[model samples]
Target: MRLPLISAFGLALFSLQQVAGITPPPGAESLTACSDVSVRKEIRSLSSDEWNTYKSAVEGAKGDRWIDWFGYLHERVSTKIHGNSEFFLYHRKFISDYEKILRGYEPNVVLPYWNNMIDYQNPAGSPILGEKYFGGNGVTDKCVSSGIANSWNFTYLGNECLQRNFGEADTIVTWYSPEFITSILQSSTTYADLRAGIENSLHGIVHLSIGGDMNTMHSPADPIFWLHHSNIDRLYAQWQAVEPDTRTYMYDGKDYAGNDVTLDDKLTYTSTPAYEVMRLGYGNMCYTYDTIQTANGDENALLSKRQRKCKPRPSKATQTIQKLPAKVLADFYPSFNKKKFSALENEMSDITPKQPMAADCSKPFTPPKPSEKMRGKMPYPGTLSKEYIKMMNLNSEEVRSAEKRAFAMIDELNAANYLSPYLFDLE
Candidate 1:
């Protein structure tokens, strides 16, 4: 007797339940499949009502201990999960769980991601970092003095205010470009390869550039952390979607301690298996990004609606920098050398500067200075500098030597753990 055939969707649902150990809640089977559920939009794409709904949920979470829960989790699991194979999947689960918590406060609330690459040239100038959103960099005492989170105080850190020091000095530095991120997405073929490319380059740079609490293991204390990770998760989702058949269940690479990672590897502090969180739109994962949705062919109708209602108008600087020719950009910004220019050209093959380039190009450009109060709070002593291009152009020998030094530092941290003296008094 031949067995009955099952559709691909049926096969996927069965595998998701059996292999990934995902059991939909009672009556959830009558609900939409995870793939057909809600969509997560970019931060700039939230409508006024959508933005207000999200902000309300975040503010509500602060009073309800949701914020503290995330901070505590990060403090406990930071070292073990970072710089390892678990980095992507662990955070994917973490953020999804966080979104679920927010939804508890407001059913309509979906956490939006910040595509930091779009603001790479001028991070501080982005509207997402404005007083209306997460707010500008830290002011006196490194306390974030603006935005919806301005009044937030964390009980875990002795009720201190949330803090952020945007850049090393009064000026914010450049970040990895969309073009560069596109390269990373295209070049990497394996889970480990993509993980290293993202964690080492784009991910690490954002943390370093932001500084303050963001630079610490308890970085989740800052609201921006969630948005940042949401984008990271979106990238991981995009990568998986590119080759869904094989990539959905793919789990390889090693943990920080040099052990091979497996699908059954449990996330820190949770009963959830890593394999369950690896695939988006399955199990606990029920959302997709606009970019991914568009790639899968809905003509981005959902994104278009949000874009019409919520997208922030691009700033003149953002427009000018994005449009500038490679040669012209190299000339205007002294940071680019021959090798770096070539790399930029390769990554941005279709870039074309707007006609009759901005009149400002005729004169030497000067970045705006911070307010007088912020000048004293600048973290670095000297004038702000751009160092990433030079760093990226380092020789192979230099790169390997630096990796050795980084590994040694990690070893020291691992050996000490909580044994190390407290850098700051939490109490």
Candidate 2:
């Protein structure tokens, strides 16, 4: 028996629905999975209430099993996740898992991402690291004394306070620019290209720039780790949204063993397959960034009343076109000589007369000299300098060695079932 032929339009629609893993109900035009919608905002954008709630959730999670849970998982998975094809997907899953734990304590809590690009020129000066937010760099003994974890103590790693030592004093590390990230989003075709671009550049810089628990295997001990990863995840999600047809279920790259990575590959410590985590709004992945939702034109994603008012509205009046004086125009279009344009200039001169130029404006336009205060005494630690690049290279090798050790330790733990509490059979 012949099957009914599906129209090309119907087939395309069905395919898109399959890729997005969401189907609208009958009579519904566009449907967003309420549970799947995760609105991650910029750290600096969070309101006072939201920031306090987030801080409380992080503080509350300290003594919870979840703290050790993430710390141990990071220790075990750090080497395998980084510098591999699984870099983006693995971290996506990791951050989602972290957010779930945070929500267990504060149901309304959603981890706010740190768009490091906003602070790319002056990372140290960003308010996200101020005493009001995550706090600045560590002081004595490399211990953090302010922000969310100021008074919080950790028991998993020898009962020490969380730490964050900026790479250098009075020096702000340069970070990846939004334009650079946009290039990666546009140019990257396969999962590997995007993964490499992100893991090496923005990802590494943030960790190194933070330079404390963030630079270590158990970086999750630092709350900044989640925020940083959330931003990374946001970028990955944004990249996927740019071309959902191919990117949603796309998975290509190499695993730690140098074997080709497939969607079926299991994320470490979770029963969930990598493919499940690759797609947003599907399986264990039930969160979307505010940016992504806005891009998709989801009106519900606009949270606050202020945000609703900020929607693009049609202008009441057409923009009035101001015509330049004929004399001024003569300079631009020399073919229309000033002599020939004199009549037209006389006609409109009253309406478009030139104002007297500022005295300094006519001066050779000398730029203000760079002040000593504007110049750093030392190069940014995150700069791609020979020494810094070499350090990154060494760090990559160190990561591999750490991964090897972690795998061996994991094997021993598995034999004794020591990872039972930390391991989740995430679907």
Candidate 3:
């Protein structure tokens, strides 16, 4: 209900951008109003034309060396952005910048996200890795010669071909499920808690499983990298949207230098303040996820213009993707007590109903069970290389805690024979 307390400098910067003739993003600047926000859909939902246009734009960028530039920028700024509060903010801006570049190639290209969680059953088997999308495992030479980046050559790191060595003989290990991510969204009461849960869990596992550039700081070299991070940003934005009154503009936790971070802190590799990115559809954040739209209150009967007949919406059976039951969250993290914890508690305000995490399921609600082949195969990711651990300044114990949480959630879901929202469509 109150305006974001942006700093004087941020206001000045906003004024300068307006005067510089830099166009504002596609949407009007209002956190609670997503009506005009540019919508990003899941990868599979893209039409044949959209996919072709995206591929052409990427190929165009690759030819102009934009791909190499992004890869280099990521490596150059990795330390400043990863392993801390800046992780979400920096990546949000980083990906948005990439999107702008993408638009330069194909003004029609609005980046889509890859909800990889759905492919956890047998990640390597997903259609996303087929010739139609991002190709899977590089050959013995580690050169990807299929899908979008096929035969792509790059000068980053001295003439490299886009590479991916799937973790296990062309098959990646199982990733975190909707259930686990739900717990993180429901339980994390601070930016740092949310950051660790994500960066240490689904985010890292996907990279490590994919291997090659994905596992390296120069990951942006891979076209899939954009879709992957876009999904991550979507989750981050959804979490902020859940309780926007208090969560928007909420920034806390330690920085890479071990200093406490604040909303006013400058994002790494950019002059943008962290607060400006704390909410979607506001400031320079012109886009909103389709899921975030449902989460932010899209009306179905009226049907938000973004929803399409071809795209799959969430299955009602999996609303659990949005949040673990309060009881389950409290069981995992006692400190996350819904009753005791409130971002607005100090302000003496009442807690409001949280946003819906996904669109209403048009189909019947049925908790489809995981296939027999996938049963009991939900494994936590393998150990990180010491270099990766140290480079990200990752807290081993915290990462382990996240592992435990995932393990616990998987067990609970498996026991209930509950199917995850992510894998629902696959079934």
Q: 1-427, model 1: which lDDT tens digit per residue? A: 1111223474355345323533433333433345344677667645567778888888888888789879888888876787678889889888888988888888878888887775555677776778878888888888888887786778988988888776565557656655345545655679987777676656766765777777677888889899999988888877776656667677789875779987777787788777677655556677766665445444235534523343222223223233434543343222232333322112232211111111122342232322333221212111111332233221244324333433333343233231111111112
Is candidate 1 or 3 superior in lDDT? Answer: 3
Candidate 3 per-residue C-alpha lDDT over 317-340 given as tens digits, one digit per residue, 9 for 90 to 100: 233322445555456533344443
* Candidate 2 residue-wise lDDT, 174-272, digit = tens: 765432454355446777777776776778778777877777778888888899999888888776665566776677867877899876678766776
Q: How displaced is residue 67 in candidate 1, in Å?
A: 0.6
Clashes of 2: 0
Tell me the TM-score of model 2.
0.67
lDDT of each: 0.60, 0.57, 0.66
Error of 2 at 64 (Å): 2.3
Worst lDDT run of 10 residues, candidate 3, spans: 346-355
List, in order, the clash count of every candidate structure: 0, 0, 0
How many angstroms is residue 272 displaced in model 2 relative to the true structure, after the best TM-score fit? 1.5
- Estimated TM-score for each candidate: 0.68, 0.67, 0.78
| TM-score, cand. 3 | 0.78
- Candidate maximizing lDDT: 3
Q: Which stretches of candidate 3 lie over 4 Å from their true place?
A: 1-36, 297-316, 319-369, 372-383, 414-427
